[model samples]
Target: MTKEQPIGFIDSGVGGLTVVKEAMKQLPNEHILYLGDTARCPYGPRPAEQVIEYTFEMANFLMEQHIKMLVIACNTATAVALEAIRAALPIPVVGVILPGARAAVKATKTQQVGIIGTIGTVKSQSYYQALKAKQQEITVTSLACPKFVPIVESNQFQTAVAKKIVAQTLQPLVHKQLDTLILGCTHYPLLRPLIQNMMGDGVTLIDSGAETVSEVSVLLDYFQLANPNPLKKRAIFYTTGSTALFDEIATQWLPITRAQSKKIHLGGTTNEI
Candidate 1:
């Protein structure tokens, strides 16, 4: 493994751009190769087995790029595939869930933590397991916001419709009066403003993307994989769906100049690379 090799990140779609944005800020010198399986996105609604397979394909592709480390940027994929990827890959594999759980545990003063993620993620109960593993006494309430991802992908983040959807999805948790809400899905952060407006000022909205980046910093330092260069590094993005759509959404949500997204078919062994 070369010291200057780029770190790899994978997501279901443009959602992972949130994680990449955080990485760019936290590790300015580290190069990154991001792959978004947008063609088969909304992994939230997919079966667990399929999500696992898709995540493996993406992880294997990134591994082929000789990435120094792998970051599973999708909460759904992280829930179903992180451990499997970690066991199979030689490099360090980091996911958004544990870091988010840790942050939520520390951020919540009331011991009531609310998590909103995709169906796959919420169903997996990864956050609940992780949070409990850290502090068994903490109360966890999880909700699946399937519509939230598409809303953000369409770039309807702060619109009235977006707020309405957020309010509807979050209404169930309001009575719980959570002190901290973990935006478990990477895409959820894009809806943070609307979510915050509905959840009120007392609740701390934890961005998993940001939390994951901090964890990545610690891991890179511990493993001596942190890029030593002082100059800013560039990031490359690839998508398994339409490049134009990915580019549009990415440019809107991230600090990307032009998304170098390309369409790829993930059906055979050739797709593994």
Candidate 2:
């Protein structure tokens, strides 16, 4: 739990980079260690037990790196594993749901908030519960956008087809009179442009990943783990799947030019990766 120790972030895939990007912007001195289980991605449609298993696998891998803290950047994983991981680990653990809910509650003028996430996330009702916990009278509407993850993972986020899918998938929330919409899944922010267009300018988009960084900053300060050095630090990214695709997405989405990435295998007992 040293200040120089990198903060670990894990997700089903590259979507967690959205959170890493914000952390880089807000906590420039802190180093980052990111892991994306791309091989078992889109935890959206998977069963809750399976999602919990996979989430723990990723957490175990990050814990090996001696990260000062852990951020559950994936909404599906956060829905199922945040508590277990927090209890198991000595370091502080942060999840994206609570921060996004707080942001939506603060931003909403009409008390109507819409949430879009994966099937597992929606089924778990984590966002719904979090929002209600914050403000009981707030109206919450949640939808599952399972297809959105594959689009971002494949780097098709800017394509015309992606735009159409965003429009069609989010149509139900457009007329819900939501003043604020929480991008419950970390992957959703990469398609933020399309989502904003579909929901119109009046609907404020709350990026849960970005919001999670704010919480991370607070925790870092409170725990006396904030890095004292001001120099920029290189971020390390590892994917259980393709390093090529993961690097491509990281280069496009992240602001740093010297981002380093590698491929790692998770299931075997050997540390072959």
Winner by TM-score: 2
Give the poorly placed runs of model 1, Cα more than 4 Å off: 231-233, 269-273
Query: Model 1, clash count?
Result: 0
lDDT of 1 by residue, 56-167 (tens): 9998888878999999999999999998989999999999999999898889888999999999999999999999999998999999999999887777886899989999
Clashing pairs counted in every model? 0, 0
In model 2, the clashing pairs are none
> What is candidate 1's CA lDDT for residue 205?
96
Root-mean-square deviation of every model: 1.7, 1.1
TM-score for each candidate, following the candidate numbering: 0.96, 0.97
